[model samples]
Target: MKNDVKIRNEMLSWYDAHARVLPWRSKPSERPDPYYVWLSEVMLQQTTVQAVVPYFEKFISIWPTVHDLASATQDDVLREWAGLGYYSRARNLYKCAQAIVSEHDGIFPNSVKTLKSLSGIGDYTSAAIASIAFDIPSVVIDGNVERVISRLHRIDAPLPDSKTIIREYAQNLFIGDNTDRPSCFAQSLMDLGATICTPKSPKCEICPISKYCVAFEHCDAQVYPKKRKKSKIPEKYGVAYIYVHDGKVGIEKRPEKGMLAGMVGFPTSEWNEDSVDNIDDDMSAYKIRHVFTHFALTLYPQIINQKTYNMIEFKEVDKIGLPTLFKKVWNMIESDL
Candidate 1:
């Protein structure tokens, strides 16, 4: 196996000049805060960096430290994390914060193994927190790094299956020197993959590591880190009952398990594979479609002007922290009222 010394040096040099200035990231001259790094990493799971910025800022402003977060109620955290999808992360984040405060004296463990023991933290997140926050030389391979490495070696194996090979190569790449900033080295690969070796229409002409890329030699840089075709997503359907009276709307808490658990939403019919029947014309105000990871949903929202049920004032709907699916339904029907 060839040494990654030259590749590492070139990539790190490019990163120093062009690395993204993100809210959670620290400049090379500064030390990263573990709290910021951990919070950002959790929010970033199955989410884009662009979407995570405002949420991270808002979270830090509200709960500046792990202790503050641990002291917060899970419902408040869920509310703050509203619109950011992947609700489970918020729950796990709350659990992990509590664990850190109660068990570890509010200090985030620097080692990957100990970090993994926290709620919601897995291999990749632990590696990221260890390397970026603590400057530990742990192997960190996110989607971007996988793409870059797959292209560099021109590996044709599809992702998931190719994950082991990709990780092996990434570990090898980071093995050469301890003196080099491990944090910078790991983030450089991530930056390269995100900005230059993008999934579609990679900007190979200006890529700093293009000289070392085997995929570039064959003129197929975009083709590395192959993924299998996605299976068909089944459609699920439901009807939302929106009851409003005296400037208030009725909302209910979802069960503490399954989709949108413990989040506030307007009362709704059961979501099922089959469609509902005998829907009245006046009740059906609007129809909205939302997509989840495993399925798509078509929700029929019905408006009922009634004061029988307990309600939240319309002006305070923001406090409910409804998930994106319910938020979309609200947006669609809120205008008519």
Candidate 2:
């Protein structure tokens, strides 16, 4: 841990040469727009970088600035944010935009406390925005940072319990003056953990700071940040009524609360583990399995003859944006055609 100088220098030098060319990223020494940084950070939460790029670009093109986003309607924002999952992020995102415009005069707050005061901006996000966008030296701890710190020190404690200690280590590792380097250093850990120090089969030979990694010296880096056995993920069941007439399919807006709230999805029965028995299996019924963070969902999508339904053309369905769960329903219906 005395090698902070070595670790920070090597990591930043590598970052300058090999930072990912993301749509929202500025160069290692350069600062990105705060709006862009905030939006990208929120979208990147619980979603992969690969999945967020197009949506990021689309949002940028559509709403260009905080004021523009603030003026946009909630439905429009949620529509654009569909398939990105975490519909609540989209809702809170809209609220955050309005808050920034109304309260902060369309400017992002500079401090962690002020940023967290906005909708959907939590501890990790506030720190990320402060360091990366505003060039404030805030400790940014994410899953990737957790992995790198856990491996760098070879901490054997499992996650959640180990989070505080890992964060303390991260705080020390990133210690320095409040400069542009903090931004670059914050992103560098993300880049390092993502590309080189991956979860499985990390590329230690190419790692810049492998010389300083205790786990690498012991030849068992992956075993650090030890994890406990994950409990069994319970399964939930429901039926999706894919009511089709003409060349279009039926879709409905979910109620304003619970899962997939305020998003467009196929009409269905109540989701319950016990409801699995009530769905009679017929030739037209196709079972689709979709996994969420907390539980796995098995949806019995059936072609039901129903009168109350909103129709959208098959070609225009993706344009309207369905959640990945309902997109699976569409895909199933298409394949059977």
Query: Any idea what lDDT model 1 has?
Result: 0.88
TM-score winner? 1
Cα lDDT of model 2 by residue, 1-337, tens digit: 5677779889999998998988898764566899999999999997689999999999999999989999999989989998898999999999999999999988789999999888999989999999889878888988889889888999988987899898788777766422347888899999998899988888999999999999999999977668888998888988888777777778888898999899888898888777566566554368899998888998998785544557877788887768899988888887553
**CA lDDT, candidate 2, residue 7:** 90
Clashes of each: 0, 0
Q: Candidate 1 residues 38-88, lDDT tens each?
A: 999999987788899999999999999999999999999989988998788
What are the Cα lDDT values of the candidates?
A: 0.88, 0.87
Superposed on all Cα atoms, model 1 deviates from the true structure by an RMSD in Å of 1.7
Off by over 4 Å in 2: 28-30, 176-180, 246-248, 275-284, 313-315, 334-337
The 10-residue segment of model 1 with minimum total lDDT is: 276-285
Q: Give the Cα error of residue 80 in candidate 2, in Å.
A: 1.1
What would the TM-scores of all predictions be? 0.96, 0.93
